[model samples]
Target chain A: MSLTKEQCFDQLLRSHDVKPEGKSAGWLEQIRVEALASAGALNFPSAKQDDWRFTDLSSLFQHAFYPVDSIASVKLADIEKFLIPDAIRLVFIDGCYAAGLSDLKRAGSGVTVTSLAERLGDLRVEENFGRHAPYKQDAFVALNTNFFEDGAWVHVSGEIAAPIHILHVATCRDAPSAIYPRCLVVIEPFSRATVVEDYAGLNDGIYFSNAVTEVVMKDHAQLQHVRVQREEKNAFHVGHGSVKLGTGSVYAATSLAFGARVSRHTLHVIQNGEGAEMHLDGLALIAGRQIADTHTLIDHAAPRGRSVQLHKCIADGAAHAIFSGKIIVHVGAVGTDSVQSSRNLLLSDKAHIDTQPQLEIFNDDVSCKHGAAIGQIDLDALFFLKSRGLTEERARNLLTHAFAAEIIAKIPVLSLVESLGRTILDRISGVRT
Target chain B: MINKESRILLEVKNLKAEVAGVEILKGVDLTIRAGEVHAIMGINGSGKSTFSKVLAGHPDYTVTGGSATFEGRDLFALAAEERARAGLFLAFQYPVEIPGVSNSALLRLAYNTLQLDRGLEELDPLEFDDLVQEKIKVVEMNPSFLGRSVNEGFSGGEKKRNEILQMAVLEPKLAILDETDSGLDIDALRIVAKGVNSLLSSDNAVVMVTHYQRLLNYIVPDYVHVMDGGRIVRTGGKELALELEARGYDWLRAAA
Candidate 1:
């Protein structure tokens, strides 16, 4: 009672000299520390946290020091090596501005791409800064929105054509452990752009990537956001990306994750305005003891909006895959059309997939459907393919790769798609060609 | 190549099979030698398809009793794929559509499996493409067929030809064409029949099962067996097929 409202944050970090600054980010960061510290026993997975029961995350917190260091030592040429040839590359290291390596064009008088430090005072940033994130509810999200060191904000001015590809690479090669690369993309009215963001690894050292991407689609602006996360199997990754759709605007997001030891992505897309649309599709190829989780939410706040969520999982060896998707068609969201599908194919008898596809609709004049299926390779199809003279193992690999290829090809980035397709084919089929 | 002393390449002895607890192929016996095309003609529900499925090792049916020997090896000891690699191919009456598996890829896998069994070096994609392009002409299939998924959304005539394309790829010692001409128009049937006829060799054999005799006009058979009540009721030369078409299956069923 003797201190200001930021008093809670001061106590948690009292042991260190990293005091809060006066910038907009510093203010938000302080709020996150306070909120997380005061989340008030809301919930913690049991030592066997039912949902987190399978994942024992005690090792993630065991590492104490994490410093931001993907600086000048991490050269632009080095980042170029991972550009996935032919892809529109945009690179970010250690969440800061590396201007020599970014290719971004200003849009229609209203759009701009600038460092978060420069846009700290921009009016739009002030308005949409942390709008969708529930700082007081979720602990980790509040923490991310609080301590994000440096990121970019992309703003589209008007009716534009062409896609935007943003590549985020965490290149911290020493000094400490973690790197958080964040981005914010804002589309103005009637503009359209496609952005493919890549998350890659350059070192064999263990690290953590806690990224947050916020996308705002204004009236009539169409945006396609494609993200690929290919971090190391030794890394720990947690990312939250949220989008708010305006009236008549369209948003499509496709994400592919080749499993890390623990990679979890929590995504939400809200159709806040009428006549808006959103599509979310993700595919994960998991092997060894790696774990991948995709949790998504589609909120139809206005009437007559459209939404779709499709997630596919292929688990080999002793890997695990999880998908939890929820769709909410509010009472005011009449005439909404939504669909959710989760399809999983397990290669080993010990491989596991936990999927729950659910829907909560309050509007009567709406169409909502959900489906989920987890099964082994169809023995009949396998036998049929094998009876043509292919070995049993070869037939199984071919059918599995075919199933995953259906979704990966839709990514549309070309080289990366094929490279990842080949990797997945080799891992699943255990064949070189 | 199959190392069997017997002149008959395929010999069935009192083959007993069942589906869902009901017996379909009951105590049936037959034999076919190399360089012979034998046809099994039967009415609906007379168990003509069951014999081919039992030979193909379709898991749905249980072979309760009896045995089938193909190329001197016990066909019952092998699963469906092993039997195919050992040179036994069954041209499905209705080939299944694999939504995302390309026809070219499937053919390459099939062809390599056979080559491996014969102790020949396997062909990769590029080499397999050169080999497959030639085989496609046998079925008169379009070059574009190599790019599309196997049997997915294909028309009736196209599916039957695709089955023959698989037979061409595997080059089985004993080719069992089960109702291979059922859904084809007259023109498609002739093309498929031509493809099947070209594959006939002195060291290999073909077994054609069909209800209609129109297909015989394109590729003549060496022998024809009229089946009724789960057994061969009549056996004769190629003339029997023409005689059955002239007289109809009712006469053969009554003769049983």
Candidate 2:
């Protein structure tokens, strides 16, 4: 028999994952072992737990547990069905990066896109791998570290103009599959690149894609990271996209969610250095009983950093949307300018959206503001448009499109935005018609 | 005075109206002959606006009793949009705004709705644009206005002028201006009043609803009716408006 639950728990005690930080390299095994123990604790969130209030967590306990495995059968042609060319594409199978199929040469010498296993084989890790993002007491980040054996290792040199795209294809056929797809991207001083975390599922079976993307950009480096989730509705997805920006570094991220029955995408960004800028734009079009939660945190550790966040949600049927964004400014982080807004549109009366935008500023000389609005379509706008020669159904479709366009127009890719726009129009056409 | 051979444009008998379960117009009566310009001046909350809304069949104002005859048809029986298509129009005091609905699209709808109502061929976009240019010029409105969303960001003056433009396009037999002069400046008032005058014909009638005596000087109603406490208390010509202006609505109410 493989390792039992108690043995796994005992092994976690011996691992470095359980040990606290700065305790030396001997703590690595302890931290990893403690991560396994934390998973077993299964901390049940109650009314006191504010994050999972809208999402049902009781059902998670009933699911049959299985170890995270890696399968090799999934082909490239099957993955190619979801690929959008011109989008810097990096394909990974199971937990390992497939260099034979991936196109990373145009990325140039200024960029380093390699597999985590290869980097480990070559002993190329100069600094700590999972040091900045510790996984001690936190169960989820710990889980990420426990399964970090086969992740994508990436680096963008300073002053580089090109962007990088990383695609994570989570597949489960016959056996219960689970993989922790981690992204470790380091941007040197004054470098610029766009990193994408595109997650797509292959089959109709129940799978789990628990991912973590950790980024650290040096001074004057700019990075744009997009996390797109298009898994099956039966899939379970819980992810974290974390970042630490140095002085004069610009960071922008977008989380597009249209899959998974229960999916939560977490973002934690820190303005560690001054003169930095950050923007987080998220969009989710949820249907059926799908649940999508996007929780973001922006910490202004230094002074003179600017940030703007705008997230829009369109929920239909009984689908639920949850958005909680927090911006925290440290006491010395003076001249910190930040603004965040969340707007949600519920198409059906049964559909629900819980949006929260909070700002906690300790700096005296800083500008910080946040707002959230949850409302249905204006009925008057519908009748007015219908009276103008358009049919009643067509009129409502136009108004809903206009409401969503306020954010979709901000996307740099026109064709993708347009196709997404049309898809949204078609989805709501039933209500108007 | 109205022309005898032209048709009885509007006939209402015992028109009752209530708002939010509170009866406003107990039982009102009014009639407008073809080509006649009728003025309705009232004290605050005398149910003047309610009367116009009742005639337009606004869903909020329930018609508890009585009937309105328009061109020999039962006007109280139709829906709001149908009433508008059946040659009936109410220029609201506070016109509602639609952010993304274009003004040109709204005008086309009104034009086509009336065409369907009158059993005429519908005008296509090309033909409609051609027809609207003449009406736009007649109202002295800028061509750029057509590109804007319907009343989305219109100024006070532009909204009233837009109301008259709708009236000009619909060409209703009996047009009710529900306190349209409340927000307009002198220039906007003159332009709107001129547009109304141009639309006036032997086949159409105009009912000017106002609280001030100033608008009467420009519109020049042939007859003026004083309304107080939910009823018309006094009836006279242009002198009544001038007299009310000089001595307030109390003097007319006390005299009648």
Candidate 3:
């Protein structure tokens, strides 16, 4: 007999039912119970859905993943390579906080960088948790809201010079496990900070990471965020990001996706107050039967809002990359200026890309422009480089590197930029097409 | 500087080429010696640019039948970049812009590749910067141009000047300038011409393919060949350019 949608979700939640749970705050427990009911009510999105048309989740659903109940051994040396120097770190393993591996003492006054399990009673967490990220329509967000136990909680009231690194490492396990990595960042009025949310895996083992990040920017707050996901090659990654901008606030984000068998990131940004600005840049470099999908929505709800977005995908070796961007201007949001461009590079004959940019403007005084381009390397440009004595291979490599460097140059971190540049160069050197 | 003992730099005999199965160059012949400059004047669709592209091995044009010898070697045997490393340069009529690649990076890479081919030491960034700083003066370019993307957002005159700047850096043995002065103003034309003249030496030669005699006035050619109907109909001294400018290509077209 074919199992119903609720029955399938029961298999996913069966393990959580057997585990002993700690007593949470009254409001937080109410949220988890409501979210569990929502998860059971929401059907799993299939290829029939518009957003899941290009991305298939059948492979991910074949395994009934159990939430990790036990702490897996992870050493500091294992995660040292992913650490950024002089930055405050809060590390998590298998969705559980690792206190020994994390450094939290360096955070200054009026700043709190700790785990959500510890800050359950904090007013900031109580106010913003499960509020910014919507779970009614998104099944993955509902699943995360139901199962997530611990995550990074950062609140900045004053200027913080050092970037905060929220590192999540998924350890290899024999049983198919599900890991929920959550992050909540709140920047108070006129405060500024930078944060890096990095997700990586320990070994090439099968696991599932359902992550959610919610960012709240107050009036005149400025934040620079960089999200990097390089999961194990055999893992499934689904991430959701929801951001709300206040009056005169600015949010600049750079998202990079490099690894995972099949991964999808859905980011939604809303400019709720006047004169807010948003910059969203993304790059997805995938190959070898991999699929990377990015769906973004930017809403200008107030007057005089501005946004600029550039998203690029490089697909090779039968890989598929998808980008769908939508911009909305509310009826009263006049004087909104937005530009979005989606560029793709297919390095092999079998590689594929699907890009769409849509703009919905309700006001006549707004300015919006968007374009999408997908093709191989320009032959004339290749010949020009060759005529300058560059070998054909070197010429192709240089052109591909330059195509990716346009977005990579905007990243605020210096060491990450250099390392990512090297990664791109190394990948392009082996590309034959 | 033309002398009888100067080595033959390029020899094209009865060359034929076509693009997309349509013949554009039918049995064209030309010859150039070291320390010599030759200008080929033609009207539109006269196969002058085709000859330059065919020699550069552009993928679009296929050689139906041709024989080209550069420095006593079969030029067709080498790839486009191999031909470049062997000292054959083709300055495009319309220089292509490469976005996101800096100007100095391309110049340095091209210079180092040729240096490696010639068994010379390659210069690092500092040394290459010193060399490029000296070469930028040839076209009177601002040092800031090296930091921008190659040829991106450059004016017509600046593009032409950049082509000559590349020519100066490569110092090719046989440099073919294809309509290098087409969109240049009088001032840019003089600067480009002067840059080319400064690169000329006893061991190198140049072939300028143009429609007007304006560029020839700045750096006079040793010989001028008037081409019509895909073949050279007349050859003369530098005065032939003046004659073509004065009488136009109608006379050559009628004869061919």
lDDT of 2 by residue, A200-249 (tens): 77776766677877788889988877677877767878787779999999
> Which residue pairs does candidate 3 place in steric collision?
none
lDDT of candidate 1 over B1-256, digit per residue (tens): 1223537888999988999999998888988887778889988888888888889888888999999898788989998888888888888888888878899988887787778788999999999999899999999999898889998989989999999988887788899899998989988998999999988887788888899898878878888887777778888888999888888898877766
- Reference-based lDDT, residue A151, model 3: 94
Q: Which stretches of candidate 1 lie over 4 Å from their true place?
A: A1-81, A94-118, A158-165, A170-176, A203-205, A430-433, B1-29, B43-47, B59-79, B112-137, B140-144, B185-187, B201-203, B211-214, B226-234, B241-256
Candidate no. 2 TM-score: 0.75
**Cand. 1 Cα-lDDT:** 0.77
For candidate 1, give the DockQ: 0.60
Q: What tens digits encode model 3's per-residue C-alpha lDDT throughout A1-433?
A: 3345455567776756855585378888888888877877776787888888988676677666777878888889999878888788999997788999998777899889998988899887999999989877788898888788789999999999888989999996887778999999999999999899999999998888999999999999999999988888889899999999999999999998888888999999999989999999999988888899999999999999999999999998899999999999999999999999999999899999999899999989999999999989889989988888999999988999899888888888887888777877877786311
Task: For candidate 1, write residues A74-122 as lDDT tens digits.
Answer: 6767776456553334567656666777765533355576666668777
> What local lDDT does model 2 show for residue A321?
90
Report residue B89 deviation for candidate 3 (angstroms). 1.3
TM-score for each candidate, following the candidate numbering: 0.84, 0.75, 0.95
- Locate the minimum summed-lDDT window of 10 residues in model 3 chain B: B247-256
DockQ of each: 0.60, 0.16, 0.77
Model 3, runs deviating above 4 Å? A1-11, A18-23, A104-106, A431-433
